[model samples]
Target: MSDNPAADAVLNLVKQQHDVLEKMLNNVSQAGEAQRKAAMGSLERFLSAHEAAEEAYLEQATKNLENMQGWVEKLTELDYTSSDFVTRFGEFQKELINHTQTEIQHTIPKALRDMTQAQIDLVQSAFERVSETAEPVE
Candidate 1:
């Protein structure tokens, strides 16, 4: 199956946001106390915006994935066989894996514990709606 343009757009946006966040984090680390605090304010806003956009786009892509069946099949269709593509993809994969591991180990659990049931329910509802729209694999 051909790649979905909408999904590609979302993925590109997410990558861009990730780059911005990484840069902001570097700035925070290098800054003085006052500068660090200012950088953190920007980081907070970027993080919140990134999270919301990711959730929305991922919700749609999740449904599309169900229709396409397993992700491996879709991934295989991409033209990542070129050396340049492979190198870049490998770097992205490493960064993504590290980021995901950190979130799973620390960020997600803390957020789950801190959030109210109502807040959790809202997130659950959003995800459920996406799942509901997904076409089951035959």
Candidate 2:
């Protein structure tokens, strides 16, 4: 598949957050109380930041598209505050992976093929901001 640098970057951003979430879950499972607490705190930040970026781009952009509004609704319905939030986050992350792949594979090329570099930069920078100082999982 031809690369859409902007979309690929967005996929990477979400993947990074998913990786962070996985690491947090694993750390919590293996660590003492303090460590688990710390890990969960970090996970919270990663999850929140990633969600923000995703909403700003993927969700917002796709909301008006046919067959994609469902995803928007799903995103809203997901409960990020449940006790099972970690595992649920994993599920949500997988959904996002699917969404990213769809965007890169089909949607991005179709929707953003003619978009300007400035638009791409705006999206990229939005994702990158979440990389820095996104609150800890707490």
TM-score of each: 0.42, 0.53
Q: Which stretches of candidate 2 lie over 4 Å from their true place?
A: 60-116, 134-138
**Candidate 2, clashing residue pairs?**
41-136, 41-137, 41-138, 42-137, 44-137, 45-137
Q: Which digits, one per residue and each the tens of the lDDT, describe model 1 over residues 14-54?
A: 44445565666566445554564555456545544444533
What's the distance in Å from true for residue 60, model 2? 6.5
RMSD of each: 17.6, 6.3
Error of 2 at 63 (Å): 8.2
**How displaced is residue 42 in candidate 1, in Å?**
0.5
**lDDT, candidates in the order shown:** 0.44, 0.55
- The residue ranges of model 1 lying beyond 4 angstroms of the native Cα positions read 56-97, 100-138
Report the lDDT tens digits of candidate 2 across residue range 1-138: 336767566556655655555555565445554454555556555656655665665544445333334443453454434445445545645554565566555654554455576776776787688776665432
Best by lDDT: 2
